[model samples]
Target: MKFLRPALLGLLSLAYPPLVYLGLGHFEPRWMALPLAGMAVVRAVATRERVWLAAAVGALALAASSMLGNHALPLKLYPVLVNTVLLAVFATSLAYPPSVIERLARLREPELPASGVTYTRRVTQVWCGFFVLNGGIALFTAIGASDETWALYNGLISYVLMGVLFAVEWVVRQQVRARHVHG
Candidate 1:
């Protein structure tokens, strides 16, 4: 339980860019939008007031991918199909993460507990983690990937921001825990 929120936070954080990358970078053969859409759906099902918001976000992400795929040139069917597959994956992942998240949610869950803001914050960390990992891979992969400025920039910004936030939270948590123990 204690380790749950931190871990879930990492997972949720992963949602942001994979969604953004699919729409903006035009980089993947297989739409990597699954995780983002999954997170949105998970949020919807898990919460009462925000289900619509989550579902809408999930739909909009898929829509954006569809639009991007169909927007110009030869109107490729690949992107559209990819979007469908990604949506399916999102659905699958969303169904399962809850069991894991709920277990983690059960831990301490102080005053604010694991609400929307907490989830979002954690997801941001996961998002940043993805950027760091992907960016590092890209940075070292070869000349072409390494040379791409947009890849480096996008990855770096998310990674740095998330890293800073995580560090700050960790430090604060440590201080509070120390005070609780000492006082």
Candidate 2:
């Protein structure tokens, strides 16, 4: 299901922080900042590959989270709630704007000539990435967490996957706009 991505992102974030405190690494948890940042960057760059890379990060994050097992259930469930809320918002906003793709036809720019399905997929991918990451973080947060910095590192990084997936939502919207002109 679509929820799977964010759920996994939640899981991936669980491992992030502990890795850093050990002096092993730090970028992992901070990487949680990426989704929103990626959205901003993609908007400026207008590069499909970058967006795709962000998406891939989301997917990997999601996949990585699965390794956490039940750890995700308690630690990072709020993001999942957030993802659902956003989905409801998106569904209400679109109201079938001609076609699913057309809904995404203009993430930031207008479509010269739009295709129904392609744009829809783009839009969907964007959302899929965001929700997965956000929801994942919430799920990670919900799980059992230790107070020490090391545990926090593992716990937070375990769910930082949201950074990438959340990036998906904004990135997709922006991408739809950028590609719209091309169509």
RMSD of 1: 12.1
- Where does candidate 2 stray beyond 4 Å? 1-78, 91-95, 98-108, 147-183
User: Global CA lDDT of candidate 1, please?
Assistant: 0.43
lDDT of 2 by residue, 1-183 (tens): 556654545444344334323422333433433333333343234335443355444434443453344222222332344355555445544565443434445563364354535556556656655555555544454454433532553345434554655466567657665776575
lDDT of 1 by residue, 1-183 (tens): 666644663455443333344444564422444444454465454446443454446454654564566431111222222233334333433454543223443465534334533453454445344444544543333223332343344335535665886687667667755765677
Query: What is the C-alpha local distance difference test score of each model?
Result: 0.43, 0.45
The true-versus-predicted C-alpha distance at residue 171 of model 1, in Å, is: 1.6
CA shift of 149, model 2, Å: 8.9
